[model samples]
Target: MRFLQNLLSFKQPSVMRRIDIALIVAVIPHLPYLSGFILAFLFVSVIVIIYIKKVSKSLVNTFMVIGLLLIFISFYGELNYAGISRFSVFISLISAMLIYVVMLQRLSGRVNFYLLFSPALLLILSFFFYNTIPMLLYMIFAIFTFSTMLLWSVMEVNLGIVLKKSLSLFLLSLPIVLILFLLFPRVSFERASYGFTNDQMMRTSHDGTMSIGSDALLVPSQRIVMEILFDKKIPPASKLYFRGSTLYSKKAGVWKQIPQKMLHFKALQKRGEKTSYKVTLYPTFKKYIYTLDYSQRALEASKITDDHILLADKNTEKVKHYKATSYLDYINAEKLSAIKRESALDFNATDYPQLYTLAKALQDTSTNKSLLNLITYFKQSQLIYSLKPEIDENSPEESFLFKYKKGYCVHYASTFTLLSRALGIPSRVVTGYKSNREYVYKNYLIVRESDAHAWVELYLDGAWKRYDPTAYATSSDLLPKENQFLNDLSINYLYLKHIIENWVLEYTRDKQLNILKKLLEDSMFAFTFTFYVLSFIAIVLLAGLYFRRDKQVHPTQKIIDKLLKKLNKRGYKKDKDEDINTFLTAIDLAQIQEINTLYHKIRYARSSSTDEVKKLNKLIKGISSKNPKYP
Candidate 1:
């Protein structure tokens, strides 16, 4: 019973508080990606740790119970989503045990050896979740804190000295770390994507299908979806229709993409000036790749479908970068194949009779006039645009056109395509993203989930032309106008994310090979430049050595050295090769004995509450020849 009491009452060492702080800092980088269960646990755990002593024991117990429940819930949730993998389970168990030890520290104040390694593990695991410049910087800071704990345990130096040495060690090792990173054999992205979160499979926007009038769906997210950099100035927001996928078949108020085996790769006729750009896409774990309107050709990493949709050969859940050339004004095809025409025109008139009659009534002498009249009809409908449109799902198109008269982009696109088919004008729905008025990042456009949109493509005058029906609606629902300053910050973050993603997160063997090939092409020039840089660095270092001053000893050590010489001059002098402690012991002078002890304490202790120099001065003034106490 006494042993139990002693164990529970044991206090933590000085490094424990810093360890807690480092763990908290490590969790910040994951806040944007973590699930609510994990975030809640972290938030509550932080509170318990911060106010552990201030709060009563009952409150601490309550917090502990809640944190444990959350951990169990999160563990089970991860297992279900990630499936039965032994490695995953083992890592999860290790993480749980670490957290449990940390919690016990708050409750019992017992020193935990397990926590000595926890901060470093947290930083390593954070790499698997996010790889960005800001995250890398925070990890470095956390590393310094971890280094302090290790240095303190072994060296037992002063606090300032410990910090300085930690910094020097990290700086000395940085070059080797970079060399290993550059030379390491990286696994292919498809085989070794970092995470196992199931959210990648569930795209929050542009899922290649639409059923707008169904029960209320997931709330829209404002998180960034893609960041695009154009070689030229970005086009107006009205012209930024970055297509991701195309949908054709429809039944029971749902529009879906039906793969056309007969419609093979076909070239798009370029109309206006071609613009080239790079796109950095966030993970959707889907095959569809986003491209600007009327992509000129297949991207290097993907294939172009008949509808000009870019399709990656395989799915991935990592941030992807690709270059594409596109013309905002272009003809999808001069001649539509029979298979595509059938796909575009196949719609049941009986299912939406009201919309079909409306389509026939709006027909005119020419296809152009018919399309114009259809646009005017929509403009006059006085329909409001909303995310959650109150309409019947059974006959969504008919209900939207004749009764409810209100819906968002998906509803407008679906209704228009059905009506155009009814009027003998072949049409298909395109699902993608569009940037409205907002601040651009330099020349790049940062597209978000809020930019997800749907539009229609009509066969007009021997070409499939773009038509957005939502443009005619009265005030569509949109995210509120964000502050310009906040938007600029977001844009800045994307700039850094892109910079790091290409160099580190997405660095592959193919990129390295390409770099080496370029280097070989310019071998002579590269060798000359390298020689000049090295010569310059050597000169600067030599110049520094020529003029730099010698180093000095510590202030406290100087004072003690002065006192030891004075003591030697008096009759208390020493033997040959005698240490300071041995000389003090042999003389047995009680007055100055404390001076020797204080100096060594200053040199050896890990941390000191009072100034070692101040204590030494106090002892010196009274015990030395100048003191009034001896007189």
Candidate 2:
């Protein structure tokens, strides 16, 4: 019990209280992504102050001013902007000023008020940076700690009691806070648009570019760019080609795509096996919106390009939720025009002579025959699937196909597209993500950036069909083992992350309305929601009643009354009009005088010292012994 009491103790020295306030303020401005330098500075500064055993108020004030100037200069770049960065810097500056006020000033009514208000301000500022459940709990704790400190500065009371009162007050205020938050107005926008702030904050792992020969080594990434919640079961790994864009032009082994006019091509609607799904895409700062094989219609606030790629009107700087319907065996049955066919088949013969020679040898009279021959030719080769493939920069195509015969999906896709174009079979390189490791957690599918993939789309038999030559190679050997403990742990982490995102970060006004609409659609849900709201109100009312119950008598008053009863029993009946001094004079005893002094200090001066109470108890016993009739 003693150890537990000590563990819950809240007593601290004067300088330690100031340091605690400073440290709490220091932590608030850097949430979600705090800088290491600032954290180290706060710790080191507090430690040095404690070890020195003395604090010169003037010296502390001077250093505070210097710190403010240095902070301003350090964030001068952010100050020039009109975004979240600038807002964060402004918040930090305000926090610094408040911390100085709390730490440097001596204990007084004014200082107590400042100390109480600083942590609340910091808590409010924290909402701008993060709004997770953990942050909400931390905010409540900040309030409780500062409130306890405020009470301690003014009243000498047990630490446990102080903590109890502060915690009760915080709990009682929560319902009101929640109500206000729900009814507050929020900014609304229909489309996902990324700004400079988003770029500065969250960077995409792999840039959405389909160029080739840029880097010899391909680094594997595990970042999650998007997650899908399908209306039905997920498709097979072989058919999971999230089409982002198509690269049709090639120059010196580097494939690139020209910007096509938005909404130029009429989407040909052909009924087939289709899967409807909703995507929760993170901020990519790019225009492309990845989808499956073919999408018949564009997502809301987005458009379909001439290359049949879905694109947002602007960059996706926010978490975007959009629905898309994709056909499993989608065949773009629209016959390519003569001009389109020539453009798709056009490639620089001089740039890829070795590929051209191979294409010439493998060409057949028919388009299907030529495509089959090329795919067969690749399968017959000894090329292996590798994460990082070594190729000669000057002759990448020749090195990859003839010498090394080991490259990644990009090499295979680029090589197949070039060879098909050379053999008069129009083809384009498709770059997007492929999900082999699809985790089914509560019906939603989670896919990571390690699934980023590349393939070829050949225009055969008046329809575009997908081909993946890399699938012919041993691609599984290049990736990590499945069903391992780490994989299971990863799935668990993703499940938790999904809950946080859906419940807190992406809970926008539209989503709230959607939730309400769904709740109202079902009788049980409506009843449950209404019941919850009413229960919350009832709880608040009950809490108010608990606080409003009649106050008990003060402990000091009870102790004084017991002493008076003992005196009355001893035949020294106190006059009703006599105060403590008059009663003590009538008694005329040294022990009674001492008891009277202690009683007056406690009852009149509002002191509650345990030592004084003990002395009064001893003095009362002495009086009782002097008069044998005392109770």
Candidate 3:
């Protein structure tokens, strides 16, 4: 029983408990928006503080400093993150700080009006990231919780009365909220409503850099990257490679593009049937465009580089709708430039002496060939393909080549490029998605982040050729055993997501304007205009009715409230729990003790005579408007 009481925070002040409830409700909506680490930290911190009963100020201060330092370090690390991403994180951190302060039991009794609204700001911030129907409903509930508690704290009312009043307030204002939403001007924001809704939604996978051997589990994202509409029958599964970027420079087990110099507007040589398609890319917070391998032409490209990578003028903070013609099989850079060749072949022999020696050992003596031998070696390497590969920091290629013989696409691609460069082949790493599901939707294809892959592009003989060592990986189990029920659920979810994105979240300013125009043109608009006029009349009548019987309340009470409001405006306000005499003296208004005495006497010392009333009124009126005046 004691544990249950503590768990429910029953010992806390009633107002404080209400505030806690409001704070928790406001924070719950941000779960999908916040990272797992921050969520876990917040959970443990709040639980520990709540259950410990007594928290030292020093301990709270220490944790506060630690949490702030963590936030500062994170902000410093992700300086290049999108502005919206940074702003959301800043708001989230501030919310955490407020939660800490509220849970500290420091203000359990003396409730401040500002304390109630602090959590309200969190609900507003959350809507900026996501406004799904469920989220909208949750936010509505959070608003009600805040309203009910705030009214209870200020008024001397029963729980039933408080709840009724709160509901009445919401019900009364909902019509106005609807009217505003219908007529208010809307604007486009959140080209990405969420950062990966940063790095958690999508990933750093499509970002310029790709690392081979990090000791982290490789979990795939189901977030749709792009939906493509093929002009004809979609290409074969083996040919559905949507290229993002070409990486040549390898440093510290990471592959990255060489210099911006490697990027150019020169076109690739055409050699096969071209498939034209329109790409509707979602927000990646990046500037690169994805297209089929060896694009013939990208209509929206600022530059179609020789590496077959497309560059856009601005980051994909907004949806990109463009068309491109591409060839699944094509020869690239038949006459590879000397500079490009050097970059592709650039590698430190000292770093991978083992890989270099192995490359030489694989050279066939009779045929004097290395390419076929390399292919055969990979086929016979018996390398298992698993997303959860063991880390090999010092020598990733060496470990994969001889010791562990286990890795995913990145490991295989990175190692293959290194070995190719060692064998005097001008080769580079390619990062993109190999979308091969039989999924289709009205002549369009949805490419998911799970299809993200890395392969090799080597300038051999006369042109660049494609090679995916992952295809030869002996054991590949990147997906789980087939679960028909689970797969059906996933498909339905994706379909619903697509529908919401098109009809609601992605409903743009133009769509809103079009809707407004249609409504205005309709005959029912006459009723809408009448309703607007009636709403105005209703507001004015309500205001008049409220003040109609103000004479019933004594003038003394009104004067006291007016004075309190003035004092509050000037930052000389008194606490609700403080006595008038104490509050007045604390603000150095001790010279006006007569007002406090008269206030008490007027209420407690029976009916005042007319003369006494006039004298008290005159003395109170004697106080100056600018500064206090004594009578």
For candidate 1, the 10 contiguous residues with the lowest summed lDDT are 543-552
lDDT of 2 at 194: 23
Which ranking of candidates, highest lDDT first? 1, 3, 2
Give the TM-score of each candidate: 0.66, 0.72, 0.50
Report the C-alpha lDDT of model 2 over 1-631, residue by residue, as the tens digit.
Answer: 9987764554544634643664465356443333343444445455655565565666666656655565555455666556325555665555544544544442222335555455566566556655454665666666666666766666555566555565566667767876655555557634222222422234343344555575636576566778887788777777677888888776665677865666555655556777898887877778889888878677888988766788888987766678889877655765676666776889778878898899899988887888889888888887888776777887676688898888888888888888888998888888888887456565567766667788988887777878997886743346656777777787777777666666555666787777668786988988887789779977876775575443434456676677788777666677788875787667766667777778878766754566887777666666553555443
Better of 1 and 2 by TM-score: 2
lDDT of 1 at 294: 75
Top model number, TM-score: 2
User: Model 3, 382: alpha-carbon shift in Å?
Assistant: 1.3
Query: Candidate 1, residues 117-182: lDDT per residue as tens digits?
Result: 666676676666544566667777877777765676665444555555666666555555665666
Error of 3 at 624 (Å): 88
Number of the top-ranking candidate, with lDDT as the measure: 1
Candidate 1 ranges beyond 4 A from true positions? 1-87, 90-135, 146-156, 172-195, 198-202, 215-218, 262-264, 272-274, 296-303, 313-321, 346-357, 393-395, 398-404, 437-439, 477-479, 520-631
Per-candidate Cα lDDT values, in order, are: 0.71, 0.68, 0.70
**Clash pairs (backbone) in predicted model 2:** 194-317
